[model samples]
Structures are given as structure tokens and as C-alpha cells.
Target: MKRSYLLIALIILSACSDSADDSNREIDTVILNDLIQHSTEFEKKVYSFENGLHIAVGYGIANSIMVEGVDGNIIIDASDSVAEAEEVYSYFSTINSNPIKAIIYTHNHGDHTFGAAYYYNLEVEKPMVIAHESTSQYVERIMGILNPIISKRSTRMFGTDLPSEQVINVGIGPYLGVAQSPIGYIKPTLTFADELKINISGVEIELYHAPGETNDQLFVWLPNQKALMPGDNIYRTFPNLYTIRGTPHRDVKSWVKSLDQMRALKPEYLLPSHTKPLTGDAVMETLTIYRDAIQYVHDQTIRLMNEGYTADEISHLIELPTEVSNSPFVREFYGTIRWSVKSIFNGYLGWFDGNVSNLDPLPSEEYARRLVTLSGSEEKLFLALEEAVQEKDMQWALQLSDSLLALNYKIDSTNKLRQEAIQYIGGRSLNPNKRNYFLSSANELNRNYEAQPLLPQTSELLREISIDMFFEILSVRLNPKKAKGITQRVCFLFDSGETRTITMRNQIAEISSTNKNCDIQVKTSEQTLKESLAGVRNPVLSVASGEIDTGGQRTKFLSFLSNFTE
Candidate 1:
């Protein structure tokens, strides 16, 4: 039966249970049952194909594929952590046992690359690590300046802190396993810009850059086997055009073009990094519909944009044609049409939306105060929030609570109501991304909920990150108030024969390679500096131990570093 029809039946069944106890609120059984069914996509097993390709799915957030070569095997996209990779390799060992000759990263996502170290260090001779030329830099950005916020958002989206029963699946995978072990990322040894064709152990492999879900995404084509590996680009679930966790604007048009490039290959077998594989004519059929769906959304959004309709208006007006929506490939399992519409509008026209009101909107606090006054009084606003919850209008209740929180009235009562609204809406959501995010947000409202640190602190992972990224992180971490009216220049001389200077002026830190004049110069190895800055080592102790020399200006150097502390 079509999944959409099944969803309609589930929605009907959910209505019958609306009167279930609210005190013991749980995810709607109908939606929970559907998500439980979806978990089958990641069933733990080694699926071997006729072309000598084996994929280990449900072992981690990504599928790790192994292609049997003449004397050795090639691995495509490692699992999320050392623990998951080791487990996957154990399964691969039973099938081939041939030493892995190469590990190819489809993109820079941690789920695809973090567990690479296990595969790379398995044999006496390390396997060649290959990726797009820009992959390493993108990895650095994630592990560097964007680490804190991305990690926080990703944690919520994945429901990593939620109890196992509360998480059915993560849309694309069963669960993210990075927290199972330290990150196992190893830098790529061989990189390419557009395409790379190589022969490993008598098996010919061709990789092409196909940017879609991620800019560094690549698709693997094996002419000998007539098999294609399209990485995250063509997962079973809808593509995450704009992840709520936050991302740079994804180029929707380029995504369509990338799908077209894949269709041109006409492979007999399709092996995606998520979900199960497809063989025969189904491969072509799936590719065609997926690309068409993406193009349809892109074109329709642009058409309405030209009509002077705002993004909000376009989102409400646009709906996928029944033909496109019925395709199992385009379901709102991950990305929804509504979110995609706004992202596409923002990508091309930016946030203005051709509306003057939004261009210079009142501050959120001021707006909240006005809303409270319009409601007749703060008490009336609180009563309205209570009424919304009583009416089961959870969305409205959540919004009303926002104003109450903003006014700093009924702090404890407002939070309790807000939590109930989010939990209710989250429990009924069929989309896992929205479900997990809402539930995670609800959990945060608990009085005793404590957040765990999510940054990569292991030295092994730190070594894979570039030293220059540390300076980039420092520049963003500069405390404007502390740096105000401060003029100073600090120079770093790494033992690897590279020098960098940081100039602090006008409440900003500017980094330069050429060190003309320096007030204080510190000499150390890049590794030492990276470790010190990551808090793996105490800088004061390193300086005292003579590992980091500041030309006897230890106090000044320490003071200089303090300005960048948040």
C-alpha cells in the first residue's frame, strides 16, 4: 500500500485516542508505531550484492560499504565513531577478510568520516584516504569555529540524550553513535577537485563531485560492476535541503543538476549511503522521480517569488503535485516542502521577502511588550496561554508563552505550559527531525536537565584539524568588551617553520601571516599550540615547563590570550 494512504489511516486512528490521559502524555501510539516501522530501514546486517559489494547498515548512522577487489577491499564512508567502525569492520571481515586498500569519504560529515581512523589503522600499511579537495577545509570549519553551536544543535536533532525508547530513528539512520567512542577522523591522504579515477587491487573506481546535501558530496561509479554509490545525495528519506540544526544555504538548482549527472550514468545497481540498495530498472525510476521532485519545488518557488509573493505566502500556497508527493523518495521523513520553500526563497532573495515591515522590525522584546499590552494585561495574556492549552491549541499556547517569558511574568508557570505544548506537538509529529528537536527542547525545560560538553577534545582528533583553524576560532571567540580600546600584537612561531601574528584593535582581532613587528612572540610546535588551545593541556604549565617559550614575558602572553576568552 502507498505510505501516504497508510499515513491518512494513522491520522484517523490518532483522532480516536485524543481523549487519552494528558497527565501521562506519550507520543501518539499511531505515530510511534509508524516510526517503529521505519526503523526497519536500518536493520543491522551485511547486505551482499551480486557485484561483490557488501554494505553494513544499522551499524551506525551511515552505511559502510565494502567493495571486494582482487587482493584487497575498498571501504566507502566509514561509520560515526571508532566503536561503530570497529563493529562494522568485524562484519566485513567475515565476508572478505582482505585488508582494506582504501577508504573513500563521500563528504565531510562526521557520520561519514569520523570513524575512518579505525579502517586506516587496521593494517601495517594504512589504506589511502581519499576525498574532495575542499573536504578537509570543510571538516576543519565544523571542528573549529562552528563546533559549539553545531554540536549543541546536532545533539538535540539526533536526540542523543533521549532515552532509547523515546528515539525511534533519526530520519536518515537509526541513531548517531559518535558518543560511543572518541571521534576517529583521519585527514585524507589523496584529494581531488572534480573527479578521480583509480584502480585498487584490480577494481576500477571512479568518483565524481556531486554537490547536493553537502557541497563536498561525491558519487562513486564502478563501470566494471555497473554499480553506483550516491552517498547522502539520494538517501531513502527526503533530502535535508535545509537542516533545522542550521547550515549554509544549500544550492537547490545545483542539487537538481547533480541528480541529472547521476541519471546519465544509467547504473544497473544503486547503493546509497542510507537505507537499502536498489537493483534493476527501479534505479532509473527512482533517480528520475527524485530529481523531478527537487526541480519542481525549485521552479515553483521561483515562480511565486517572481510574482511578488513573500516566502511565507509561497510556503502556504505551494504543495507538491500528487504524482510527486506519492513517490516514496520525496516523503517528509527528513525535509518538508514548507521548510524547503523558505530556504529557497532565502537562498535567492535573502531575508527581506520584499516586505518593509520585516526589513526594520521592532526588537523582539519591544514586540513582546506590545503583544502583552494588546492582550489587555499581563494576567490576561497568562490566562489566554492557559486557555490555549485547555483548548488543545498547543502551537498557540507555545507562542503565547513566549510573550509571557519575554515579560518575565509567571516564570515557572509559563515554562511548565510551554513544555507541555512542545511535548504534545512533538509526540504527534511523524517527521523524526521535527519530533526529536521538539522533544529535546521540551527536555531542556526540566529543572534538573544539564547539558553535556560536545566538543572534540581528544588529541587524535585534534591532530587532524589544521593549526590555522585555531586562530580562526580565537578571532570569533574574542570578547568585544574585554578587547575594547585594546591595541596589541601577539606573534606565534611554530617549530614547523610557520608564523602567525594577531593584531587586536577596534574590538576585533585580525590575523596575518607576515609578522613585521610583535609585542610578544611565543614559540611552540603546532601540535602543542592546538592541544593547549583546546584545553587538553594547561598553557600556564606548558610555559612554566619551557615547552612554550614567551621570551620571559609569560605574564604578558597569558594576559594577551585572556582577551580572546569568552
Candidate 2:
């Protein structure tokens, strides 16, 4: 309890250092090739091609997937990073003189797109960029929201924040012992909306925009050669019902449909966006198993929801049937079925535990303040939090501490104890999203402790995001039932005459606005959206910043939104 009071004092003096520095880190080019940065496959490059004109630049262990038949010699998902790009470039230099024709980006995901940017300089025409229309949007969205969080979370999860040697694999991902800088989000020069067919060096490539795990996704097919690369679709484990990084619910129906499409192909060679390549009849058999894994999760979760099961209950009760789990192709690496179930449930229905008592329930601090009168000391609250943390009780601790801190900012140990306790849990956590939250919470707390009084410009820069973002967050905080039928639409006008639209539906907020709106509506500002999406901006102050012009109805729109999850 004494420590708790002490942390409060420290937070008041140190809240200023909460700014996070997340600029793009430079890619190391020297040891790019020889270093495959050991993934699950963990093997050296394997090259084999049709007529020796094309080559399979293998990664992860087996040449899981290949970028063959570029006009002359270009890697599909060129060498893992910039460094890898250099080595792959060096190796190809010995074979082909076609100036590496072009990179056919299967999708918008960073793994497929980032490294290829290095190849543009080696060519004259800057290898014609191509992707699904949403691929461009997906790249923007991830770089905008997912990547930064994942990068920071990765640092903590992999102990990049701690000494590198001490970090051990929790057995989830392959990169368990590397401290690295964040990668840049490479923008695509060429984009496609739906279906596109291109002839690169006689390789008939077909790109279809299939919204499965990612909105901007593609599946390429070569009919003459009987080859198919299912970008991320067939790449990750299982059917990938959901992602660990918090995003919208992926369409399990669409995902299943895509696999069904793949099953129809029965191609001789199957290339995934990640992992190893699989061939022959087992490929078809394995894909069906993969398809079933996702289908079952989506179908069962829907079944449970229809049966009146809440999100948490469905998450706890749901499981892949015996048939799906028994298959080797249906493994849980980056994307887990449990989360896929949650994402599906969340998209269809907002989050509600199904208890009426939880409907507009009092904040933890409200209850805690009342408890203080009964318990008569800060020591009791301290003991309660201590018990919660010790019991591995995250939700309870978040609720209790939130209320406690809201009630008293004078406590000294709040930041330190919270950081220590949360870091301990986050370090050992298996779930990426849950682990990231704890780590971020600790980061915030540590920032409060490290700063002498208040956060500075960099931290405040994080504070300038849109209100629509807050409403989305509020939806996450509210009961799904309450979130039902809730819809908000607003336009914000920036001083620069730029406008952004904030729309929240299905518990997810999509913030985008066009400069050509009839009212010249400012959907959002560049800085504000960044701050809000990055968890840096304060929503209330964002409204007060005259940088936005909603025209006439913006205020009433704001009021309606303010009560969203409250």
C-alpha cells in the first residue's frame, strides 16, 4: 500500500515521458543473404525452376513458396528483408541479366511487399507495382495500426526490451532470440481492385482480390503451368479464421470459399505466402483439412452465438472438432483458432458477457472508493490488486487499477508496481494480443515513472487522433448488445481543407474521408488520425483543436458519439 501511494507520486512527476518513438528503422544490408534469420523451415536457399529460366527463392526451411518466371529474374516475395534482398540480388546476378523483371506482389501484407522495394533501384522502369485495390488499403491500415503495435509487442514478447541472450522461445513463433528494429511499410506503386491478369516472361499470372484473412488479399493462378500461389491464404496455418493483432472480423465464409476455389484447382505445385511449398495429392488433402479447420470454427462460433452464448463463453467452449485438429496442415502458428473464433463472434456481435448486471455497470474505482470507507485504508486496495496480479487475474487487475488510479493519482507505486506486475505476466504470456496489452500498459506506466511531470510533444503527438477512434474503443468497452444497431457518421475538416470520415459499425470504426465531399468534410486530419490510431491522442482535446471543421452538424455528431460506450 505504501508502494502504491509512492508510485502515484512518481506518476505525477513522470507522466511526460510516455511518448513512443516508432519511426522506420533502417534495414541492415551487409549480411542479408547468408542470413535467412531462421524461421520454422530454417534452411538455406533452394533453387529449381521450369527450363532453368525461373528459380525458387526458398525461405523458412523448405522453399515454402517460390517467385519463379519473373520477366527475367525478380523474386515474388523478394528475400525476407532489405539485407536478404541484396543477397538474393547477388545470387540472381550470376544467372539472369533481365534486370529482375518485376515483383508480382501477391497481396498487401508486409512480408510480401517490404523487401521488394529494394529491387526498384536495380531496374530502370521501377518494376511495375501491382496488387489488389484493397492491397494498397491493407498496407496502409497495417502500417497505420497493426505494424507499430506488433513491432512494440514483438520487442516485449521477444524480450527485445530486455537483454537479448536472456530471451527464450515461448514456443509460439520462430524468431525467439533476435533484437531488431521495426521495418518500414512500403507503399505500392501499382494496385488492382479485383481481378487482374499479367504476362510476365510468358508466365500467365492471375490476381484475384479475395477478402479472407486480409481485406487486400490475392490468389495467383498459372493455368498453363498448373501452379497456384494463395498469397497468405494457403500460407499460414489452419484456415486463419482470425489474427492475434486486433482487427476486424475476417470473413470465414469468404475464407472457406477461397479454399474451396483452391481445392477446385488441384494444381501440381502449391505455393503459400509463408511456410514451405507442398505438392501432389497430399496438397489437396491437406488443404481440405485446412479449410475444415476454419469452417468448423466459424460454423461453431455462429452456432454458439445462435445458441445464446456470449463472446467469452463461446471463446472458452469452442474447439476444432477431432477431424480438423488431427491434421498436420491445420497448425496454430501466427493465427490461432481461439482468436479466430473471437474475431468472428466479435464482428457479428459486439462484446457482451450476457449479464444484465454488466450492463452499464459501475467503474471499478466507484466500487473501490466505496470499499475504502468499509476497509478504512489504502492498504486494503493494495492488497486487492496484489492478489489479483498474483492470481494471474488480468481483467480484474485492469478493472481495479483503472478505477483506483482514476480515484487517486497521488499514489507512488501505481506505475512501478503495475509495470513490474504486468511485465511479468506479459513476458510469459502466449497470446500475442493479450501480451501486447500488458506490455503496452507497462510501457505507459514506465513512461509515467520516467517523466518528471507531464509527457512532451512526441507523447502529445500521440494525443491528436480522431473521435471516431475513441468511439470504436468505447464500443470495445461496451456490451455487444448495446453496440447493436449503433452507428455513427461524421466528417472532420482539417485546416488544410482536407476531410476525413469517421464511421463506426459492427463495433469497428473505419476512419476515412475524401477531400471532394460535397460539404468539403474533413473526415480526419493526418496528425489526429495517427495519434488516435496509435493510442497517443486524447479524443476530448482533439475536438477542441480548431484544426477540424465539421461544417454545421459536427457538434451534435460529437455529442451522440461521446455517449457511445459510456
Candidate 3:
């Protein structure tokens, strides 16, 4: 009777403690909204540059700049979101009643293009939307490719999940807002081939292809007026490299070259995509510093690669000198140099360290499970994990939990860990992208504990990725030495008889092959294919596991596969 009473008392105490904890956990909804609110609440400045030439800055969501050319008035890169765009329209109405002749989007990034719709949604017929040809090739494909990934990263960077907070700012100024992108965005209608010179209100705004932030970047240069628009390409901050919202690695070389191109333009005053509008010879100097800062990342990465430094080592070892890292223009607002350096290394050298020990690696979860076995007893392992968590070593805590959950069933320690880890990581404010993953993982683990669902398998995870992320996954499959000659040709075929072929040449994965009679046939609907490539699994994996005939054309197809360092 005594032992039973003791057990009952313990259960009651646990319940009481949980209730007390829940009561104290305030939502702070007001603060969350305020974070979203003040994030982009800054002064919008209107400056008259030259004769009838003027530009508007300080827009929430996306940067708004009005160019009063000779033809009429042209708006370049309308703000990203809806409410922000309308405010811009209101700002323009206050300035002048001049009809908008055209709206040119510098690139395909949602921010620069989406704002075009708001004015059209109003009484005005939508001004012709302009962009580079590459941007318009297939708007659906690009969105299908990047919408989830970029928005996810952007959401994390901007703290789109929660309301928003001062600590979670993604831009330098208080102007850039944070939030998830709505489902639909305005697609560019008109596009340029290479370069085009159009007179917007007699203001000669030369639209040239300067692929900086995105592949289809359009830079507007007022040659006669000595003014320029670099869009998101030449932000006042360090170029966002390896954004937390996931995408393929950006080419640091191309990025730097674009900045150099901007520097050569020698514009007196410039309105970039983010931060404040910069003017004077000081603008050029700032641009130069920004250019050299990116170059530092690229050059150091290559040098380390030549010396055969591993990606992890390169990420930790490479650092921008004080001249670059600490520069006002190089602050990590959108992206960090550390992640960028890692990206450069990952882009060139691939993931492997050329070591045989890491050649045939088990999946992360499976490896974690085995580790728990090696360490012995659940209680002892839990103690180590608690210590790591207490020390604020989130990295180690996460790694330890990986195997802990992998190893045991119905362990109280795992449940405690799930609850504690979530609280711990949820409190820390790191990079938006990293925070999301950490928090999401905590959520996932919590849900798993609440229900004790079976852990996911590596194969289950890989087969569900999309075309964009498949390259990253494929890179991981290669050994360092075999990675040298592994170029690949991926031809995506849709039932509509339309086909898109991607040729990944040079650098890592130097070999190539297509799905037409290649190794590893992936026969599925376009959506399924997309889901798989995006690193988000599709239902087809279940069918594959259940021995279902879901594997259509590519079920048993095999492509020539090899690894190479280009």
C-alpha cells in the first residue's frame, strides 16, 4: 500500500508541474505581431536625382523605387507583398498623377516581381511587367522549383513563422518585413534577351542582364543620368550566401563579377534592393568593399579546395579578414560568409573528404541509434545528453538525441529530452534558417514522442526529394575520389510531352546521363517527381515500401553513375 501511494504521489506531482509550466508560458501575441509590424516600419524617402529624375525608397516587404523618365514614370521592382505594394502605390499617387508606363522586375525573386499585381488589382490596367527571358522561360517550373525552398528559407530568415521580432530582423534597416509568402505571386509578362535600352519618360533606363541574386537578374542603369539600380544584387549588406531557406548553392564567382560590373558603372547615387539608398563617391567605395568582401569568400574557398580542405574544415577555417568581414556593408543581414564559404566548398569539392572511412556511411538516424548501443544503458546516455543541453551545446544535444531516440522505445528520458530540447532551442535566436530547423526538429521529435511513431529511414527520405534538391542529395552519394568525374544529365519528362533537361557540368558530379534508359528510373507524376526532388518525400515512397506497382517508367531504370571532382 505504501509503494502504490508513492507512485500515485509522483504521477500527481508530474501533472501538477506540467500544469504550472503551461500556465506561465505566455503567448505574447501582441509582441509577435509588433515584431512583424515594426520590422518594416521605417521612413520612405523621396529624392530628386536629376532633371525630372526621382526615386522612392523605404518600402515594406520589397523595396519600391519610382523612376521619373522622359516617357512618363517607370516603377522598377515593385515591392514583394500585397499591403506593402499598395502603400507604394499610395506613395506614388502623393508624388505625381503620372501614369505608370512600365514596371521592370530586375529578377525573378518574388519580392521584386509580386508588387506589380497590386496596382493592376486597382483601377489601373497592369503596367507591362518586364524581366529577363530566362526568368519567363517557364514561371511555373521556377516556382515549382524554388517556391517552397526559398519561401521556407525566407520565412526562417525573416521569422515568418512567428509574428516577427527585432532580434529576428533579416534586413539592416527597420524596413524589410518578415512573414511567409502567400501562395501566388505576380509573374513577369515581358522579358529581355540580353540588354535593352528603353526610354521611360525620356529617362534612359538601360536594362542589362546582371545575374547577381538570381540567374535572370535585370539591372537598370541610367547611363546619361549617371544613376543605377542593382536590385537585390548590390544590397548594402554582405551578399546572402547559403540562406537558411534552402536552395542550391549560389555561385560566389558570378556574384562577385556582378558586383564588379556594378562598380564599373560608376553611378553617383544608387538605390539597391535593401537597406538605405547610398549616394556620393562613398557609394562606389561601399560597392568596392562589398565586391571585395564576396571575392574574399570565393578566393579563400578555392584556395582551401586546392589544398584539399574538407567542406567542414573550410567552413570553420575560412574567415573574412577585418577589412571585409567587419565592413559596414558586409554585415550578415540576409546571409553569412561562413555559410557562403561552406557553400563554395560544397559546390566545388562536394561533401566527401576523400577518406575511405566516410566513403560508405550509414544514414544519420541509423548511425545515431548504433551510437546509443555503443555507449550503453539509456539512463547513463541520458545523463550525458542533459549535461550537453545544460552547457548550451545545442549541436551536441541534437546529435546525442538523434541516437537516443533511434535506440530505445518507451524511454522516459527521450520524452523529457523532446520537451526540454524544444524549449531550449526555441529560446535561442540564431540565424532564422537554422532556428527553424532546430525548432522544427524539436516539434517533430515532440510529436513522435507524443505518439511514438517509427523513425524515418534514409531511403524513405531520399526518394521523396525534388529536382532542385536532388543534386544536393546526389552530391552526398558520391565518394570524394569518385566525385571527380561524376557529371550528370537529368532529363525530366512530363506527360504533356514537354521535357526539361538539366546538364550539371564541371566541378563535382562531372559525369552525365538522362532518365531515358538511364540507371534508376523515376517514373511518377510531375507533382510526385517535384515532391521527391524538393527533399520533401512523396507518397510514392510508401508504395515503394509496400511493394506496390507505383514505380512506373523509372522503377528499375538505371543511369550511368560515377563521382568526379571537376
Number of the top-ranking candidate, with lDDT as the measure:
1
lDDT tens string, model 2, 1-566?
Answer: 00122232232223222331222011111121111122334333544556332333333111223344655654565433444455556666666656656666776554565555467667776676666765655554444334446555444443334322222221222322111112322445567777888787666777777778677777877777777777777653455566543456678788888888877878777766555566678678877888888788888889998998877778889777887787756655346766777788878876665679777887777777887667676677667776876675755665556656867844656545566567655544434334444555576565433311111123332332233443344434444454467666655565556555556568565556533334224445666655643445665556556444445455764554554444
Cα RMSD (angstroms) for every candidate in the order listed: 3.9, 12.0, 11.9
Cα lDDT of candidate 1 equals 0.86
lDDT tens digits, residue span 71-92, model 1: 9999999989888899999888
Candidate 1: give its CA RMSD in angstroms: 3.9
**Model 1 residue 244 CA deviation in Å:** 0.6
Writing each residue's lDDT as its tens digit, candidate 3 over 93-208 gives 77665778787888766666655656545545566777888775333433443444554544444443332322334453332332223322455666778898876567777888
How high is the CA lDDT of each candidate model?
0.86, 0.54, 0.58
Cα RMSD for predicted model 3: 11.9
**What lDDT is reached at residue 344 by model 3?**
77
Give me candidate 2's TM-score against the actual structure.
Answer: 0.64
TM-score against truth, every candidate: 0.95, 0.64, 0.68
